[model samples]
Target: MPRHVAIIMDGNGRWAKQRHLPRAMGHRRGVEAVREIVRAAGDMGLEALTLYAFSSENWKRPAQEVGDLMGLLKHFIVADIDEFVENGVRLKVIGRYRELAPDIVALIDDAVARTSENSRTTLAVALNYGAQDELVRATSAIAARVAEGSLAPADIDTDAFADALDTADMPPLDLLIRTSGEQRLSNFLLWQCAYAELWFTDTLWPDFSRAHFAQALAEYAARERRFGGR
Candidate 1:
């Protein structure tokens, strides 16, 4: 089984449009997909699951839509916290958390703290996350350390860079799935997905089911993960 599975959840708005429903409705339905996939991943013995919930660029969206997303996230916290614990799923967030509203940050912190002890599966949500920002932040941290005489520039290496990332505690990605017919990473996991298998599908986020997830896993199982080997 794959140790870590990362997903770029896309097509919520488009899915809603196709059904003549408001985009908020699609986002609401997409939340359910998150629940299903989290359980499906746990049942499949995956140790870590990382989801691209909101990107740094998502701020370009309209104000109302962004507000709705933030509100939906709060609702997700209220609804999923107990279920996360009941399912032995650990909740974690990796992103530029300081940029979020205080209330949302508090909710996320509470969720992370409450589920810290769960051992069966780990669910990591990437909120306000962007790979480029993570790299820039890490670089700034390294520069500060060097300026403080606390570290030497030559000491930096791949592991050093990895340690500086927000996802330092999580396992490296084994597989990356992008749904909604998208075929790009869009600047995710720049430092961690060194050798992850990639899967893309036309299935939109709101309509993404466990069967689609399973198909991605099945495809992953069929590949040769040489990690640059012959």
Candidate 2:
């Protein structure tokens, strides 16, 4: 079974356009999909699930859309906290969290703390995160340690760098699913998904159902991952 599944949620705007609904409504519906997937993942006994909620490039979107997303996240934070606790999902946020609005950031912290004791599954939300940004941040932190004389440059490698990133504590990713028929990575998990099996589907984010999730899982199980070696 795929223990850790990472998702690149795509095609919300397209979904809205297809329905003649405003883009904001699409985001709202996507929240429902998020809810369903989390429950489905819990039922499936997934050890960890990481979602690419917002990427660095997402900031370039229209101001109104961005504001709507923030509002939705705030609502989600409040609405899901209890559900997370009840379902034994440990909530964790990974990325440039300081970039979020102060209130939203506080809510994220509160939810994480409240669900910290849960042991069923770890739900990691990647907000304001970009793969290249993560790499740069990790490299800078490591370099600073070397400058302070506590770390040696020669002693640093993949293990040292991995510990500096936000998802350091998590296990290697097994499967990654991107909806909306998107075949490109779009700079999601640069380091952690080094060997993960990729599954892409045309279903929009709001339309991604439990069966869609199952299909992705099945696809992942069929792949023969060589991890860069034959």
Candidate 3:
């Protein structure tokens, strides 16, 4: 089995439009899907699962929608944190998550602290995340170290750069799945997924199930990863 898998949960808005329901309703259902998938990943013995929860660019959306998304996130953490601890799932948040609302940040910090020792699986959620922004931040930090004479320019390498990323402690990404038939990465985990196999499905976020996840894994098992070697 692939040691790590990440997902771009898309199509909640489209799903809601298709069903003649409010977008908030779709997001609510999407949260349910998140719960199912996390449970499934743990049961299947995956080492890590990273979810693209919210992107930095998402701030351009309407104020009310953004507020709704924040509310949903707060609810998810409050409602599911117990289950996470019970199932041995460690909670890790990436990107500028601390820039979120103060109360939300506190809740996230509490949840992360509460589940820090779990070993069964790691669930990394990318909140206020953007690959380009992450890269810039990482680069800026490394440059600062160089300026301070604490690091040499010649010492920079892929490993050194990766160590500065938010996912530095997580397992190397092995498979990336994008739902809702989207075939693009959407600026999610660009650095971490450099060599990961890509999978896309027509299933929307709210409709994604364990079966779909299993199918992706089965396909991953059948393929050969060259990793730039013949």
Q: TM-score of each candidate? A: 0.96, 0.97, 0.98
Count of backbone collisions within predicted model 1: 0
Evaluated against the true structure, the overall lDDT of model 3 is: 0.96
Please give the ranking of all candidate structures by TM-score, highest first, separated by commas: 3, 2, 1
**Candidate closest to the true structure, highest lDDT:** 3
lDDT for each of the candidates?
A: 0.92, 0.92, 0.96
TM-score for candidate 3, please give it.
0.98
Model 1: residue 5 alpha-carbon error in angstroms: 0.6
- Candidate 2, residues 1-230: lDDT per residue as tens digits? 79999999998999999999999999999999999999999999899999999998899999999999999999999988998999899999988987889999899999999999999999999999999999999999999999999899999988999999989878789999999998988998888878888898999999999999999898888888898898
lDDT of 1 at 7: 96
Show the lowest summed lDDT stretch of 10 residues, model 3.
185-194
lDDT of 1 by residue, 1-230 (tens): 68999999999999999999999999999999998999999999999999999999999999999999999999999888999989898998988876899999999899989999999999989999999999999999888988999889899888888888888888888999999998989999987888999999999988889999999999999998998887
TM-score, cand. 2: 0.97
Q: Report lDDT (Cα) of residue 151, candidate 1.
A: 83
The residue-by-residue lDDT of candidate 3 on 1-230, one tens digit each, is 99999999999999999999999999999999999999999999999999999999999999998999999999999999999999999999999999999999999999999999999999999999999999999999899989999889999999989989999999999999999998999899889888999999999999999999999999999999999888
lDDT of 1: 0.92
Residue 41 lDDT, candidate 3, scale 0-100: 99
Between prediction 1 and prediction 2, the one with superior TM-score is: 2
